[model samples]
Target: MASGMFDTPIVGVVNNLFGGLIDAPVVGRLVRRGLIKIRYVGRRSGKTIQTPVGYRRSGDGVVIHVMSPDSKTWWRNFLGEGGPITLLNFDGADRTGHAIASRDEKGRVKVAVQLG
Candidate 1:
């Protein structure tokens, strides 16, 4: 799948093969249209995080999926500070949000990050 575009050759091949099992473009479209919202939590501080992922919307509240398989810098910061994140939305406004995820959630924020 196209998701493998961000990975090494072998990993990309694996990602392409695995992505075939899911409708990523549909989900991406849903996410872009604001129907799907992605919620991230601080790995260390237990705070809610929200960000408008690049995708289109199918309707309202469709599942937002993650493509990468690792942690990011903001994820690390969220872990250090436990509080809900207010993400910037369309019209340059901030959105009030919270995040709650279980082990079975579509995506999970982990406790790893690079700060350089």
Candidate 2:
């Protein structure tokens, strides 16, 4: 694996071999508390589009960082057709957040802001 490429297998290895429990809640807490960042992938293209996303304590007030990247098909659908964002907690419970970014500003610095 390439450097800094800590993929799922590596995570699984750490979790299995060292008994490290790396789940959504722990990761989400890191993201929530601003320890680590949360990245969002484009649903259609499966590309990493958002990084350093900010999440609120209640899992609301989600801010996405696109880093000046072009919008993808999934983002288009999310903007046009209106889609649901499924956020899973550590307990495997999925929470729904609403996409509330305006069409005119979707391509700007602020992409989509999901609020619970």
Which structure among the candidates has the greatest TM-score? Answer: 2
Candidate 1 stretches greater than 4 Å from native: 1-52, 55-63, 71-83, 105-116
How many residue pairs collide in each prediction? Answer: 15, 0
Q: Candidate 1, TM-score vs. the true structure?
A: 0.31
**Please, what are the lDDT tens digits per residue for candidate 1 over residues 1-116?**
23344435765465344333222454543333543233456566676754333333223212233336342234334333333444333223444443222223556633221111
List the global CA lDDT of all models. 0.37, 0.42
The C-alpha local distance difference test score for the whole of candidate 1 amounts to 0.37
lDDT of 2 by residue, 1-116 (tens): 12233333564454343222233445545433532233345657677543233333434455544333342223343555455554444224545565533334465533354645
Flag regions of model 2 displaced more than 4 Å. Answer: 1-28, 32-60, 71-73, 90-93, 102-116
User: Model 2 lDDT vs. the true structure?
Assistant: 0.42
